[model samples]
Target: MDTRRILRRTRTGACLLAAVALLTSGCSFGSTTRPVGSAAAAAEEVPALTPLPRSTPAALEPYYEQKPAWRDCGAPGFQCATLKAPLDYAEPSAGDVRLAVARKKATGPGKRLGSLLVNPGGPGGSAIGYLQAYAGVGYPAGVRARYDMVAVDPRGVARSEPVECLDGPAMDAYTRTDVTPDDAGEIDTLVAAYKKFAEGCGADAPKLLRHVSTVEAARDMDIVRAALGDWKLHYVGASYGTFLGATYAGLFPHRAGRLVLDGAVDPSLPARRLNLEQTAGFDTAFTAFAKDCVRQSDCPLGGRGTTPAQVGERLKAFFAGLDTRPVPTGDADGRNLTESLATMGVIAALYDESAWQQLREALTAAMREKDGAGLLVLADGYYERGAGADFSNLMFANAAVNCLDLPPAFDSPDEVRRALPDFRKASPVFGEGLAWASLNCAYWPVRATGEAQRIEAKGAAPIVVVGTTRDPATPYRWAEALAGQLSSARLLTYEGDGHTAYGRGSDCIDSAINAYLLDGTPPTDGKRCS
Candidate 1:
């Protein structure tokens, strides 16, 4: 899945959602699309991973037991450290990979409760970025005061030895490639694109690519846990990070302690199942957006009497119109708004409902004024592409981790063709494009190192699995499935619109998580919050 963590910031802390919407608001809700592993996609499982890699084995204690040589990070209060983990745990004698870690010590007069590790779900999102940007400074004061906020950039994410794929110009072409192909020639073009992209990563970082699987990352986390002097791990993971934490729990049940898995993913499902469900989740989000939009003056899709189904049809028509004659975005680079880009701009807003109004405005611009600048900005934001054209390794790592965690969702266009009807049934608006996007890993150079399976984490402490009813990236059903699979799981339901629930302006979610973090008391099973 696309690394699901909404990026923490931009040049403006508010992000480009508003600016983009004001320009591209004419095409809201009805036509959201991103590659299957978009920024809000779910994140993994493996067999050697099942028994739980708990105690430091005799052969590897040397690496795990090594003390972190901490140093001040140029940031005032945080300390940074480097950790070492066996590149191949099964063959510890081969080599080691260096991991980046950071922490803000507890600022307390109260008794310290050790460290609380935080992951902001990308499978690619930088945990260190999350820690410094939000968790360290914005988390509940009590929690921060008593527990050091810690983070470790996964093996192939930012700050860690990153995985590099297509560079900027190449990426721009790849991103703009038509996902909803019209014919076999277009299908060949899409398949060629996937192969080119995957080939770039393999050629650029052959060794690292082979080692960045989810189980390996989870194992890396265990080493970080031991290096931090914590016998047990306390973590709060959102979206894809939820999958990571759950993986860790399965891999090391006895080491798990007080984990809050918001936007939970069902580890048991394969990529095809996960991708299909996520598409449905986006459709659910659009329905909510449409229901809200018709109530407003600038509703682009429909009016008071207009049904969501009609809104979807109108939006699809708009996308089709873009295919024949692209709109000028009025950008300095003269980038026109293509169907793929307009769809990406729409997908950008699905992560948070607060962006719904912006989406409406964006659609208005595209439909009424034929301006595409705003939509382009949203696409940039989703891709984490800065105005300067520099991109983080988020998408690269996202695909690397995701592709390794599960076999490709479909092997070829023929396979996707067979599956297209089912996908369309799931998401008439976005299904075809997403089905094509799923073909990305089919061309991956390395074979998958993990498989989808239930993670019981039987001996772990009470783990809280949070779900949002209208969550677009991680379907609410996945949360229910995950909660059911874990031996000791509590479901915290947020009946709202968005991706994950822990701190999206919800007092109910915050309080329950805080109580769990501080007192080791989880909210009762099936607790509902809005």
Candidate 2:
């Protein structure tokens, strides 16, 4: 999936509210909802929180007292395990955090190239889920035979001691927050809702919250590498995983083997730039969808005479309408299609081309049918709100990591108001609202612990950076930026659409990545594929 879409989807309104509830309840939710104090002031006042020292393999023995039951790879011959690590790395004596690990052994018709770890973005998406459902069974046979395919759910994510919040009814209410606030009162309501949600997360999962940062998760990957007996890490990271992998390369350059970062993120940008660029990206994808829809008989935004711009305007107007009146979804709670849910549905469609049809059906249902069931499904999928209205910790952890990675772009409501014009210029449909939404982390309780820094990883082996020309999430420029930044980076370009280029479709992209993993032959610098 496009890293931006994945991030935006996971950090949607409901998720943000949950994260806020998780982080800010004790600080007087009503009184202290301002941006974090200045870093200098914070540093002088609040001691820097240190991470615990790394534990050796021997240290992990006690935690691994019980062996996991190995199940069928579901792809003929793969094995899975539950690896345990300390929840509070600073205190190894504390309780354990379990990660679901999966591996498809090398077929071995060729020489073994060692393990190749793969992460399919989301920061919330399950790596094991992706492997079992797709990569493990569907990856090219040559590559599969030469390298052991491996995956691990990051800490605080699915199957990894997930951070849980909200019962069914509460979540139903949370998902319907109005994103396009019509007035000051509406905006206050939205902000209050976010505060409540974040407070909930703080209450529900305190220990897990502090340790879910990208840096911490990157550290966790090193532990997984040691347990797997790998001398160095050879990996493929998609979407947000690219950030995780890049952080690893930065922290342990010498340990980085052959790494491939696809659908790259410009780790150097702050949250505002990230959200603004992403808002533009959604516009690009929506424009593509609009054009295609106009050409089809079932086009919901009217026919050829109506331009994509007009379609976007219509959608925006629909969102504005929802601010006043939400469309009913027929669920028991009277679940309605609010502006936040509608925006999430649009963001979800940008991940894969196959979802465009679903988007069309959803838009049709919302605009004409006036039934929100279709849009609700799209929103639910984005939140990973499954059968019981239960949510995955993906959204929770996504915020925890993102909030710690950088300070919020906007320090106050005034800043967001000033940036709206530029944001809308970037993407008329999604700009203003998303630009406002991007201010969320500014209100996070914990001060940001990291800043944007360039990654050179000088001693690491050649690493591949892949970019798709028309990728909606992580834009093509970010790939170029990342490739240029890494000392040994090789740029692999996929001249296509969608999020990450490899495995989703293009053989040219997949083969180049496979060769790098199996034979340690990085693709020629500036290799372009279609």
Candidate 3:
């Protein structure tokens, strides 16, 4: 599945919901009452535990024993370091991959709680970027005061040995290629784009690409934990990071500490099912957006009382018109808004309700004023397109990690064609494009090394799994499924809209998670917050 930001920033930060066909990192709660009375009392009742004995293989002891000589990085109050991990765990003699790590020391009033690693998802999203932009500065003061905030860009991601694919111009072309093909020629162009992207990645880093799977990334986390002098890992992972966190817990159950998996992905799903479910999730989010849009004076969808399906029809018709007649976007690169870009523009805003007004204005500009600049901006944000030709390795790493984690969702156009009806049923507006998007991995250079399986993490400490009832990138069902699979997990529900719940103005979620991070107490399982 595609994964990126749990909390996307844009220009200063980046995107949230992964594009359909691309898996993304993206979570909810509300009663203000602290679950177990006071934080002080809860802190006093810290859980007793026996530390897990280090089981580092003799071949890999060097990596675990190494210490990072932290130094000042560009971002204030943050120290940066490079971590080394085995390129191939199966053969430690093989070269090494250097991971970029950053941290902000605890601002203490209470006893320090060791390092608390945070990953904002993106099978491709840069963990270091998330730490510096949001998690490091924006986390609750109580939690930040006690725990050293840390982040490591995963292998094949930004700051690490990033996996490069297409250059800026080529990537721009790829994004514009039509997904809803009307003819064989259009289909051929779409397929050619995917093949070129996969081929470019293989040519750039054949060896590195093979080793950037989730399993390897999880293993890297353990090495980081060891190097940081932490006995156990305390982490907050959102979106695809949830999958990574679950994988880590399963692999090193005893090393698992207080892990918060927000906007979780279900480890039990195959690639195709994951894509299908996410498409439906986008539709759910759009329905909510549409309902709200109709009540606004500037809404482009319709007047008050317009059914969501009717709004969707208007949008689909607009997209159809764009397929033949693209609109001017006033981009310096001369890039016009195509059907594909417009779709991405709309989807990006669905990640959080705060973006709805921006989307309304964007839609109004595009549909009513015939100016596509606003929608183009939204699309650019989703793709992490920066000034001129500059772009992050997010899409490249997104594809690399996703293609390796599970087999391709569809092997050929015929397979996707056959699956179209089910996908359309799941989401009439987004299904067709998303179904076509799922065909991306079919052109991967390397063979798949992993498969869909449940993560039990049997010996791990209590883990918290948070879900938003209407998260577009990661559906709520995924959280439920993951919680049921993990041996020691408590599912926290947010009856709300958006990609994730915590730190996005949810006091209940923040307090519960904060209490768990500071003390050893977890919210009661199945707690619902609104």
Q: All candidates: CA RMSD in angstroms? A: 6.7, 8.1, 6.8
Q: Rank the candidates by TM-score, best first.
A: 3, 1, 2
For candidate 3, report its TM-score.
0.92
lDDT scores in order: 0.78, 0.71, 0.82
The best candidate in terms of lDDT? 3
Model 2's lDDT to the true fold?
Answer: 0.71
**Residue 342: error of model 2 in Å?**
1.9
Please give the lDDT score for candidate 1.
0.78
- Candidate 1: which stretches are off by over 4 Å? 1-49
| Tens digits of lDDT, candidate 1, 1-530 | 12223454211001111110000001112211211332123332332246644456899979877899999994789999999898888899888888999999999978999899998876677889888877888898999999999999999989999888888777777777888889988888877888888898899889889899878888898888888899899999887788889999988999999999998777777677777777777788777888888889998888898888888888899999998888888866557898888888887777788888888998999999999777787788777776545778777888888888888787877898999998788877876777677778788999998887778888889999988878777777777767867889988888888778887789999999999999999998887877
Residue by residue across 262-334, what tens digits does model 2's lDDT show? 9887665656666766666667777777888888777788788789899888888888888778898886555
Tens-place lDDT digits, model 3, residues 373-477: 988988887787888868888888888888888888899988989999987887788878888888888999998888777777888899999988888888777
How well does each candidate superpose onto the true structure, as a TM-score?
0.91, 0.85, 0.92
Model 3 scores a C-alpha lDDT of 0.82
